[model samples]
Target: MLEQKHYDVVILGGGPAGTSAAITLARTGASVALCERSRYQENRVGEMLSPWIRPLLTQLGQWEQFRQAGHLSCPGMVCCWGNSQPYENEFIFNPYGSGWQIDRNSFDRSLALAATEAGANVFFHTLVVDVNYEERFWKILVRKDGELRSFKANFLINALGRSQFPHTKEKIYLDSLVGVAQFFQNVSDFAIDDRRTLIEATEVGWWYSAQLPRGKAIAVLMTDRDLLPVKPKDLEAYWKKSLLTTIYTIARVNFWHSANKLHIYDARTSYQDSFSGQQWLSVGDAAATYDPLSAQGIIKAISNGINAAHAIASSEFSHAVSFNDYNEALLSSFATYTTERHLYYDRERRWEHTSFWQRRQGNHKFLYA
Candidate 1:
């Protein structure tokens, strides 16, 4: 039997949320352990960083390191939803600043490593198997190298991404099937003048394309559940077929090169059990997930982690208040996103001639707050 080690806080999942929380808690002189099932350098989407995250990164002393890693700066977004009149939204990140288009693999790893440097014990290749609360502490079971180990902590921060935890009946959110494609190639000729133009093609959910460093372009496609099958393996073929069915997507493909290599990412949104016990608090996508169309994934995750750390660092009563406040804020954010999504669909309904727009426009379930 392995001996159990104790810590003030134990964080599961080493993504942005978990790392951020670990770093924050460690900085406060709390004993912290962060466990990750996979290496942080895995390829994934949701790479577009909102300007809102810049302040937090700066506070954490990571902004300079991130910029030194050679990410592309993005000023704003240009949106086209199967319509002639496209919408443009510029972000004033600072009084006068811009956002970024990052390589997600490098970005995620760097954040996790930063937590380690901040004095948090980080374990990669460790899978959390069970979580139980006993007498005022969380007892976490983890499998590392096929060996079972246990750890005790005063509090547990669950930052496991979507669908990582066991599902329960009280969780009410439905799953959304989102398909994405990315590639890295020398496409300087096809580059748009505005780096922030994340194009969208309605009938499908949305598509964001941006230029990265080293003459590379990243294009992501998000499709509705009814239009695209769940978890299609051959994403290139599916993307080509989706483009053929929609005129808007066809124009988008025409704008880019046909020869570029394509990398695919499949994403989903499911309800999370936000709380397991008095000492366990779920953060980031572990607590709740949303559609990628909002472009709030990274920012939201970081914010939740920071909030969780603050709560855990305070007294017990303060922790409960913070968690309640976090939940209320998340609810408000979801409501706002749904309202905007519906409005976008309403605009698409006036312009697009397809069943995709019709179905989305009439989705009464989308208005749930």
Candidate 2:
């Protein structure tokens, strides 16, 4: 029989949320284990880290290190949101200087590695296939290095992105949100302003495009499924055709040569009905997934992990109410954000007659796959 290993906390998924939680717990002299199933990140979409992320990094004691990673700065967004004419929302207006546009792989790896640097035991290529309560602890069966290993922990944290955990029910705030994206490399250089992130909304949907480091650009369209082309065989042509419909993208992107396979991403806004139960809790997308418009994924995950750790470390009286408070607070905050989303979409009256805009007029809360 294999000997069972134990830690005070076991964090599943080595992404920002789990790793952040692991780092926070380990800092308090708690034995924490982080099990990451994959050593690699899959195809990821463009990520625009908000200017507010500066303080979040500072709060986590990773400002210097994150800055050293050398991601490209996105000073502002050139938006053609509700009108024909484009406008700019500069991050310079904020107290923080600029935001970041990252190659998603590098961003995630930095945080996970940071957790290891903070003295948390991080196991890569490890999958927790089975989880159960045994002897008042979380009994986890993980497959690592082509072998099985058993782990026990007083607390278990799920940060496995979305739909991976069955213990908690997820409530979808906006169900019909998804994206189709294409990557362009060796893109021609335009004016310096062309380097800024670009957003333009059409009658059927909206488009987001940004120039990354190394002359690469990521352009994507977000819309309801019904708004997409019905034939998969026509998807390639449809993608290029639709991208050309954008006010800014048509002139900026070369559809003739830049045509490539479209990558579909699930962009639903949602949250688990319950964030914590017994000795287990969830952080990041496992707890809640936000609208891409909010751009709060990284910051919210870090904040959730930090708050979860502090809550667990508080007095008995405080600890008793911690998770509930956390859940309630996030719920309230998301509700407000969804309301704002409704208002934002409402501004585009030209598309009000379309199903896309008409649907958004309703409170769109539905199940996401």
Candidate 3:
């Protein structure tokens, strides 16, 4: 076993939020240790990067490099939401121009690399098994390839996406929404019209498909967990049946040569009762998760990470004022999100009779479970 190391801040998970927080703290001369469970080789699902990400990345000194990362530029979106007919929503007049369809493996690796360059110690393939607080510091136990190590920090940051600390407040899941998705290969030759993301609403749920970087594409069916098949083997059949129900998304799926097996992921809206504690705080999905329809997953994660880091840097780990302000901001933002989500779901009345749509039609707070 190696000697226990102490740092000013210890962060869990190396996704956008973790890396962003590490970069912010490291640049301020704070000792930061970031732990990630993956080696940046896995194919993570979140791909859409909104146009608003440019300002956030630029603020973190990573915009110029991200621009040269070879991600596909998404001009706009083609949505068949409230009505059956599809329409174009171009970004021609937007100040930030177009969004991006990124390869998560590469995009996430780049962010971790940036954090390393900023002087943070990044541990890949490391899992945090336990955490304890004593003597005004946090004690973390981590394991990698059967080897155990320990770390101590004055403050803690959880950016583990959907995963949360066992001791923190419980996550209030808004709905039982899940995405059954599949990836297709050899799609670089897809039509220019297919370059934009396609969103089609159906009676059962909604369909989202988009062209990905490196000659690949993705198609997903978002619906309630209870609405899916009971058996895992029957999910493909259900997914195919759902695909047939979409008009525009099915056409986009046809362009791909072949698809991999189906994978299910939680796509629900959730938030914790509190985002911060006495000496720790959560960011990204760990703080609050949004629906895919908002296309703000990455945007929100990075924004919260930067904001949280600034709050931490403004005062001591035990200071209540900055943490209080951070908590209040997160709650205010989540309240606004609930209102907007209800309005968007209410826009689709064609499926009002279905259980899936019925759950989303009323007040957003009522949907929480």
Highest lDDT scorer: 3
Residue-wise lDDT of candidate 2 within 288-348, one digit each (tens)? Answer: 8887776778788888888777666552323234477867766776677677777877777
User: Local error of candidate 2 at 220, Å?
Assistant: 0.6
TM-score of each predicted structure versus truth: 0.85, 0.91, 0.96
By lDDT, the candidates rank as 3, 2, 1
lDDT of 2 at 348: 78
Per-model tally of clashing residue pairs: 0, 0, 0
Each prediction's RMSD over C-alphas, in Å, is: 3.5, 3.0, 1.8
Worst 10 residues of 3 by lDDT: 360-369
Q: Candidate 2 — which residues are off by over 4 angstroms?
A: 170-173, 188-193, 255-260, 315-322, 362-369
Write down the lDDT that model 3 would get: 0.88
Between candidates 1 and 3, name the one with more favorable lDDT. Answer: 3
Clashes of 3: 0
Question: Which ranges of candidate 1 are over 4 A from the true structure?
Answer: 92-96, 167-171, 186-193, 229-235, 244-276, 316-322, 350-355, 362-369
Off by over 4 Å in 3: 316-322, 365-369
TM accuracy, model 2:
0.91
Clashing pairs in 1: none
